[model samples]
Target chain A: MKLFKDAGHLFRLAGVFLLGTLSFLAIRAFVVPHSFGQYGHYRGAAIAEIAAHPVHFAGHQTCETCHSDIAQTKSAGKHAQVNCEACHGPLAKHADDPSIDPGKPDVAVLCVRCHSASAARPKDFPQVDADQHSGGIPCTTCHQPHNPVIAAGGAK
Target chain B: MPGVEGFMYPNEISLYWSVLIVLYPFITGLVAGAFILASLERVFRVEAVRPTYRLALLTALAFLLVAPLPLQLHLGHPERSLEMYMTPHRTSAMAMFGFVYLWYLMAVLTVEIWLDYRADIVALSNSTTGWRRWLYRILTLGSQNVSERALHIDERVGWLITLIGIPSAFLLHGYVGFIFGSIKANPWWSSPLMPVVFIFSAMVSGIAAVMLLYMVLMRLRRQPIDMSCVDTIAQYLLYIFIIDFSLEMLDLIHRIYEADESFRSLDFMVHTRLWLSQVVLQICIGTLTPILLLFLVQVTKLSVPVRKRIYVVSGSLALIGIFAMRWNVVIGGQLFSKSFLGYTTYKMALATREGLLVSIALTILPLVILWVLVKLLPPWPEKRHAPLPAALAAD
Candidate 1:
């Protein structure tokens, strides 16, 4: 007691810190999510929550049912590996309602996104200068929509 | 989409870290640097630099308080930052910063200040009147003992805290460097010497800042500027700056020597995208100009007025240079694509949450806080009236 005789200030400061730390721990316990750090350092429920969300994008199988002729043309062409909805936006809503018209994608803009001339893409990936090649004409005017290699009259 | 050049990845088009991220390291660097300057007088017993000792500590606290605001504003969900303290990711450098900040703020800086000022608080509580009396009374923490033994204990404990603080200051900014340095994925930020360079730069900026503040504050109060103190501080600033510049050059030379796959892309970025900020402003105006000015004063037998002007110009340039360094590190690192194929641009939005206006406001907020703190607890050595507000000064 003699050592701490005039240390009432230090005692008071310690008391303040003790109360503060305890209060902080209590508040932290209250706020921290129960599911947090369950699997790792994140809320475990997030993975399942994201998974439970409804799936979009009707498969190429779904598109084949409605337009078998286009599917057959796409299968034989240079775009054999590509999917029906790859160029088109998500068609889950249109797939649900058959009457819902998924409007045609604008080939002037759409075709260039992948086919734009760039050093990044592989050498033989069939890229083009959309500005000089088409010159404002829609891509469908020069080539078939499904089989782009075969020209509009079915000649290569 | 508009700012894209070369071959940026689809996801790398829009930058995640903005100008706010630039301020985060810059502000924290000031805190680290200021604390180191204060610790020099306390821990090292550098008698000549005694004038700015308390001012440097107060400056550290003022800037340390504002340091987290930039990070919070940058976060998408600002509220979730607290969760870092609750369950910190053991490996995450950013997450661990919360604990480092809390330790430096609450455990180190605040405790050291209270202990250092306990005697003054108790004495002022008795002498002062009204809310000021109550304010000092609360600061005294119930015990009014300014006894010799009590004061001795405060000094001894404060010394110990300052000893702890020297390394803690290093950890504070060095860890900030580690935050960028440890990002092994980005070649620009992945240097092993980032922490050392950051520490030295922090010291340079922090020293320059206090030197400027001391000169300006003295002029405002119509007091004679302490020439010897400024001279000593300027000497240290110059030396530390040399080390910092050398370390940075070393990193650059090493990068050039070992030209990795990403070097060509980074080289192009430095030439084109980063030329203005990195090459012109940061290098020429910010770093070298100030170094040359300080060097002139150091070597030459200049008049007091001339030396003071040189100090002001050099200090201002040092701060600008450090800020530009932080800008280049945060914004520049993100400008180039990770694939070594492309580059993008950071278009600073106007009048938004993370914008130039908010950043300017955030930069000024610490100075406003320093003003209030100076009024509350006078850091000056001489027995003069505190710079109270007009209404309070009348009392």
Candidate 2:
């Protein structure tokens, strides 16, 4: 009580610190099951129910087996640093239901979640405004999911 | 598709946020302009502008206070912005913005206002009680002694500060131009004349802002219209606007003459990316129209009523013009891809915290600061028993 009263208007600082500490602890507490596969049976059961297959898709090697062109394009594009599933979400379904209609994810949402508020992004990289992009140009018009490079990165 | 040599030399155009960062000085230009309008009356004995002088100073100071907010919003971690001060580097022009902001705030605006209103402070100090008294007391800085000699000294010091601040004003806004101009990467932004163009435009915007606010304040207070003051302000606005327009034309001429490899791309960006802001709003509506109206009023010896109306239209246009210029420099620069082959648009979302809300906050923060400043040192002198004669009042 004394500390709270003396804190005056420093409540924001205290709250940020408290939230950070709690998040750290929560991450640590949840890590045990994730690393050990202690709940592997439940996870497999859930995956089977949802995706109808539990085959592990280990990175690009799993992706290249089926779609070599996209893999090659991905490697050549600016998105080489990113994994296919990073944007495509879980690809387990794509492998399982051959007729699941793998329509693209809303590209604007996937891109702007990082690009607009980005810090270390390259200079002259276009910023996506929610209202404008939501209105006129759709995401795929400017960006390609399989291949996203600004003129093949030769654009100094 | 694999091989290409048409790829431009020195390719990195600018950072996404660097464009927005440039807008900081553009806003500061408005501040410098408004402050100079005030100085014309306060320090330079331009009695015809006395009506709007105090209001102009307040407006300048108000905008100056908030000029950094947009830059802060553009930054990834605004909290880390203070590091610019702790870790100042010589090569980075932006690293010096902190110093420029401080010099303008502390040495220019704060000191100028306080010194200019010392006479009023001593009077207000004795009249108010409690917190107001304490506020006035602190503002006075233990100087209750406002004798004839002290008043004279204050005036002298105020004049000196105003003189010194002119270059600082130039630096504050001009340095922003320097940042853009210094960039060898973007042929669009890179120009030796960018600073000159920015400074003149700052003057234009500043004058227009003061003219508008002065008219508004008088209407609110129900004070009689000061035609002489308005006319004088209008004249100064015309001068600055003419110079600013000329400089812009010069910049365009140079670009046309050079016709470098990047010309086609830049010209395309200007037409498409900045068409509305640069051509329609800035050039046609804001500049030419205002200049035409001002010329009609000043040259034709129009009626007082007609001139006043013209001032209203012209001043508003000038203000809008300056803002459009800023938008062109800040938002427009980022539209063109470094590849110079493609262009993109910036979309501002309405519902987000970082969108228009932060801009509103930036605009509002200055008014709050002004209110606090006026509370600390009322810009106008309090009506007193031994007030100076009406003749001296003209001073």
Candidate 3:
């Protein structure tokens, strides 16, 4: 009788533990406040953070020192709004070595992050796609980096 | 003149009271329309509409509860939107909304529903135990007696409340339409027929909802549906849909006849940008199809199965069509540029908690409320054994 009672108590304890674990899992999956998606949800501050802390991502400035012409055009264009890490993903090893070249990331996916109509961006913004944008001109040719528009004064 | 650049579509209009403001009345119109249907049976003793009366009231309440959510979401500072009430600003049309909401919820609907169900609540309280017993008792409000006198008093009070509620319902939804109609800035929303159009369409949607719900509920319970009850509801739905569709056509006619300076741009928008939504979906699929189906069912003297199928299909169409109408009026109107030169597109994002997910949750919340309401009040009166129909037995 003592052994039977002990077994019953152990079963109840197991039931309680199982209930707790299930509840925790549900809350984590459905209700918890975790940031979501990479489209419009990416804050400008994250871009600024990447800009301010160049040492963290193999310093775009170091590349600028060696490759001035490409860097100048890139800095001037609208692509300036985006950080290299956002488009290329993490690049700690590639940043450390000058000899190893990391090829351009998937251009279609990167552009669609902002350009797609259904992408999680501004509501009033118009739909965009590579086909619609390609009028015998590449995105870089028309857009320039960080600056889509050219100012009156150049970097003379 | 050749060298000058002119804006095809202007961006000069202020979006102060925009699309969100327009939806407020559309939703309220549904609430009022549903409540008025409930009043037809509850107050006027319309035996044919008995099945729909309770369902109508609950539908009205459900829509009413969520009416302000869109407006709240639209406001730049939703938290500060409450300041309209605290300051008691007379010029602010939105200030009166809170008072209107409270009066309907507390002074009218709550009282009428309670009085209507007092006897049933008392009975349910006695039959049940545990939390349900306590719930029923509280709902009964300590009224244990189910005597004829008590019921008579309840019926009288319920009637009075319903009478008072009808005008409040009109004001709530009508005011919403009026706000849009009065906006002189947006020519698209500035028609005088806007309020009339809103109220009638609301009626169309409301009557259709009750009919669909009644059919579904009866089927679920394995009970035989009363064809007379359903026919009556369908008949009312047809009447309202005709008026609603006619008013919309009349507005279009008026716009064309007037041929204002904005006519070209507006016409282009209807033909090009909104052709699918306005011409195809709203007119052809939503309104015309349901109206035709309802007409065939009523005029043709069809078989039971055929009529039932038509009624369900028509009701479902009318509900969806009315929602599409609201969407077109709110979102579609905003897509065209004020300059009449260019049109901008709106892209709704997926996976956002504030977007479609919230709307779905709000829409389905009422089902939960209705289920609990049935569990508590049992909308229909209890069935008692009788040798003959009540009307014949009495005679």
Q: lDDT for every model?
A: 0.88, 0.72, 0.69
For model 3, what is the error of residue A70's alpha carbon versus the real structure, in angstroms, after optimal superposition?
36
What does candidate 3's lDDT look like per residue over B1-395, in tens digits? 12112332333222233444445555676678788789877666667987778777877777777778767866657766654444345665667767677778777877677666666676778888999999987665554655554455455556788989888777776776776677788788898898778778888877887788788988998888889888888888898899999999999999999999888888987887678877888888889999999998877889888889999999888877887787777766676666666555544534443456556665676667777666566665343111222333353
TM-score of chain A of each: 0.82, 0.50, 0.44
The model with the greatest lDDT is 1
lDDT for model 1 comes to 0.88
Q: Write the per-residue lDDT of candidate 2 for residues B112-174, one digit (tens) a residue.
A: 877666557667778889988887776666656555545555566667888888888888878
Q: If both were scored by DockQ, which would come out higher, candidate 2 or candidate 3?
A: 2
How many clashes show up per model? 0, 5, 16
| Cα distance off (Å), candidate 3, residue B175 | 1.5
The global Cα lDDT (0 to 1) of model 2 is: 0.72
Score every model by TM-score.
0.85, 0.68, 0.67
DockQ result, candidate 1: 0.48
Off by over 4 Å in 3: A1-156, B1-26, B76-82, B383-395
TM-score of 3: 0.67
TM-score (0 to 1) of chain B for each candidate:
0.95, 0.90, 0.89
| True-structure lDDT of candidate 3 | 0.69
